[model samples]
Target: MQIVSALSEISDRYDALFVDLWGCVHDGVRVIPGANEALRAFRAKGGKVILVTNSPRPRAGVERQMDAFGVARDAWDDIATSGDSARVAMYRGIVGQKVWHLGYAGEEDGGFFTPPNVLDDPLEIARVPLDVAEGVVCTGPPDPSAHPDVMRPELLLAKTRGLKLLCANPDIVVDRGDRREWCAGAIAKLYSEMGGESLYFGKPHPPIYDLARRRLAKLADVPDAAILAIGDGPLTDAAGAMGEDLDLLFISGGLGAEETGTPRLGDPDPEKLAAYLEATGVVPTFVIGSLR
Candidate 1:
């Protein structure tokens, strides 16, 4: 469906809103025009908004990024991220266990902060033996060129050691600035292809949504019907909302530009969108250029 009327139709029904960060609110560098206004309007109408993101960085880092883009923390009730989800997973108890971190050292430390034991060197983890190691937490995509190996030895080691792989971010890729780059999900996919088992903890998975809901519940009583999710990517935003039975508003100007066919500003062509949705089987409840 198209959005000709003010978003209040959906906004008024729901007491809280779960908004996606990257595409819907801003690109990696700047806020999308009208998005901030739309969020303000929603808040003025008494709706609580919780900004959710799949960024592998810590919540503080996410906040800094948002601030750089002009989206103040006051604009939203709370922010939920993949890093936060990972922290929750770690805290559930895996103490004194060695973990093989598959992402950059910066990201590993940021995403899985405060873990019982986090080892950046694959050799250190391997030497401990898989049986002694607690699990593998894949935080970001590995650089194949740098590693010079298509099939990472870490994956084989994990498989041989029978390690449990926990994917902190389930997004395969995301739009950053003007380019798309691989995420933790890409590494997780590679591991899975090599017959490794994994547990994903971000979008399109039920646990993240549950976490968002709990965060929203604190601000106001959120009804399933009134809540709406706006996002750029279908896999994480649209699919995740649909999985939770919430209405979704797709922003075509975000990630996977090929899927949206070089999105432009203003309203999208319905005919083109319908074809794309049909091909992907991920139809949104409504469509807009952006949240604005």
Candidate 2:
């Protein structure tokens, strides 16, 4: 991958850009340095930017959080989240079926039963026990370490009962301030490994990309070849871009810096980056130390 200093270096090649929210635009609590400015600059030059995120929350909820973080509205032309796509997927897949939800205790309304867009509702779902439920929907963990073991008994019960798992967020982990927390994908992946049916609705999955691509198309009639995907996660961003056949702009000093031997605070080591890309077997079209 060719290393560059800023998005402007290669921004002119694409009519639209699919940018990741968490690691590229902001860490959990605050905006990343120069990220908003870079996005605004890209847009100023007539590029449509879509904030495609693996966040478990819907676009409205994420937009509110971004607004609170002082992220300007002009930084992005549109937004799409894994939660929104998952809701659409679940609505179609589990019409009129009972499902048990596994997620943060207080965020019940965020599930498929009561989506942000009521027009897309396909069912009048009735909650049921794990053994009797037709499916299971996982948004994310309540705690930082909530993963395979934390939800093992429930997941096992669902597995034994043959309930399909709909994972809202395919991201395994994300930074919440200084702590890294496991997302719904961790449980879904474990369930699949144990011979259970699981459908992931986010990155590295076609469904979420389909939604994002539609949104991108609405903003501009850009082909997949002309769209650039920017992100930090190798598993989610890089894998998703490769799966969708889009070029990637990998941010080397973000989430996977340690494994890639790129320092978090300074310039990335090109040799180390090459090794990391070789080992992961996924290469981006370009590499930037930061979104700037």
Q: Pick the candidate with the highest TM-score.
A: 2
**lDDT, each prediction:** 0.71, 0.81
- After the best TM-score superposition of candidate 2, give how far the Cα of residue 224 lies from its true spot, in angstroms: 1.6
lDDT of 2 at 94: 54
TM-score of each: 0.85, 0.93
Error of 2 at 5 (Å): 0.5
For model 2, how does the per-residue alpha-carbon lDDT over 1-292 read when each residue is reduced to its tens digit? 6888888999999988899988888888888889989999999999999988887787767888898887889899998888888877666655227788777522433443554563455656666777778888888765657556777788788888778888888888887667887888888888898888888878988877888888887777888888999998888999999989999999887887776666654567877888888888777999987798
Model 1 TM-score is: 0.85
Between which residue pairs do clashes occur in model 1?
13-226, 14-226, 34-292
Model 2 clash tally, residue pairs: 0
lDDT of 1 by residue, 133-251 (tens): 77887677666233213547767887887777878888877676676667788777777888888878788888788878888887778688878887767778888988999888777
Q: How many residue pairs clash in each candidate at the backbone level? A: 3, 0
* Cα lDDT for residue 197, candidate 1: 83
